[model samples]
Target: MTRVDDPATTSPEQARAAFRAGTVAPTSGWAPGFTQTNLIAVPRDWAYDVLLFCQRNPRPCPVLDVTDPGDTSTVLAPGADLSRDLPRYRVWRHGELAEEVEDVRGLWQENLVAFSIGCSFTFETGLRAAGVPLRHLEQGRNVPMYVTNRRCRPAGRLHGPLVVSMRPIPAGLVGEAVAISGAMPAVHGAPVHVGDPGELGIVDLGRPDFGEPVEADPGDVPVFWACGVTPQAALMASKPPFAITHSPGHMFITDRADSEYRVPVQRNE
Candidate 1:
């Protein structure tokens, strides 16, 4: 299995360079300490509603940055161009996925606002450091995500079922896992559910709505955490005229460190 020691994958700039040059791999385990985010772009006409949506549903759609209309770079990662940084982009038109691209420069316009949402990827750093095994990272696959029966708070034009990313954790270490990740509420916080995929309406843990599935060890439990992809589900449900988002697992790496977002939560789980 590949590890996080690759030099080219250890810095946001180097990682983005690799992405810009046609490397279309999932961003997991890359740039270890730096923060990675989910990208969502919308027309200025829908900016207010989008912001409100994020504010109301911070678990799955935590708001990190919202660029001014037409801007491509972000305050969190200066010198980084959102149009070309992520490994892939998902373009949405009227709630349907329209196109997938590497560089969004051609799609850039004067009235589009970019929103950076906190991703579960950011909290994985703490988990790894705390000795939690990440099946997706160790197996070299995109983290599996699913749409759940739970509904998110409805905003002006954005409302949809909640989505979550699942990770298999050793049954004994579940508390440690929660404490490590709970510290980073800015990055999706901790697991929303600890066991039983059926509770989330997930009939088969092997089949996910997005990304690849991992094999669970005998004592490992399927843990679900609020995922950033929830916003994409919203986009498809709301049917906005036009939008762009980072393809699942294609996160936007930032200059910030994971420590900046960590604040351990008092766990009762």
Candidate 2:
């Protein structure tokens, strides 16, 4: 995987073009104002279960769009190839990660149905605009994610523990972060928990279940948000026969704007 210098100004088309050309990198800072998504593709036989799973747990698996069986196109980003536009992908076999690849075109199955789920990255620009410092971006690392003991409501055969991404925010700005993110329900909005990691069964913040460990500063509060990686955790737990997902942090950048997912707030006159 490589790093993109000055990704803040990158465009969705440009990011996808770089990915399509085999450039691998976490998409956190890429194309700042655009929406990013988590990619998950499963056999048509399991499409209903996937949809049901997302419906049962909207906080962690907010679906933006779903492709019909074997269709690689999504309305979220027209002309983008689901199998090739993402930076990195994970291939699952009978519940285990079989391989990590740059592209899934060769592994694409005719019966596969792909889901484009909303990502926390989509709301990051808003977080920045609100003056919330992003430690992972500042540290040049992928956001730290953890698998919790809390279980999600199961959909058919899909059942797994909840997974979350943690960002350490200054104690004073925690509320502002919450207020800014809570408005965008489509992108895993709001903090599921703040403060103690052990409360969620996370033993050590440095050793996360997924992504990289990030360093928190003094007076920083660890804030947890429902993560799109929840589906991957479900696949690992439920042992789906076959599935494909974006490698955590390596998301699919969409043409849509972050404003498209934000919930407008009404003010009192």
Best candidate, lDDT: 2
TM-score for each predicted model, relative to the true structure? 0.95, 0.97
Instruction: Write candidate 1's Cα lDDT for 71-114 as tens digits.
Output: 99899988999998898999998999999999899998789999
Pairs clashing within candidate 1: 183-263
lDDT value, candidate 2, whole model:
0.94
Total clashes in model 1, counting residue pairs 3 or more apart in sequence or in different chains = 1
lDDT of 2 by residue, 189-241 (tens): 99999999999999999999899999989999999999999999999999989
Q: Worst lDDT window (10 residues) for model 2?
A: 1-10
> Which residue runs of candidate 2 sit more than 4 Å off their true CA positions?
1-5, 266-269
For model 2, name the residue pairs that clash: none
Candidate 2 vs. true structure, TM-score? 0.97
- For all predictions, the C-alpha RMSD in Å is 2.8, 1.6
Give per-residue lDDT, candidate 2, residue 138: 98
For candidate 1, the lDDT comes to 0.89
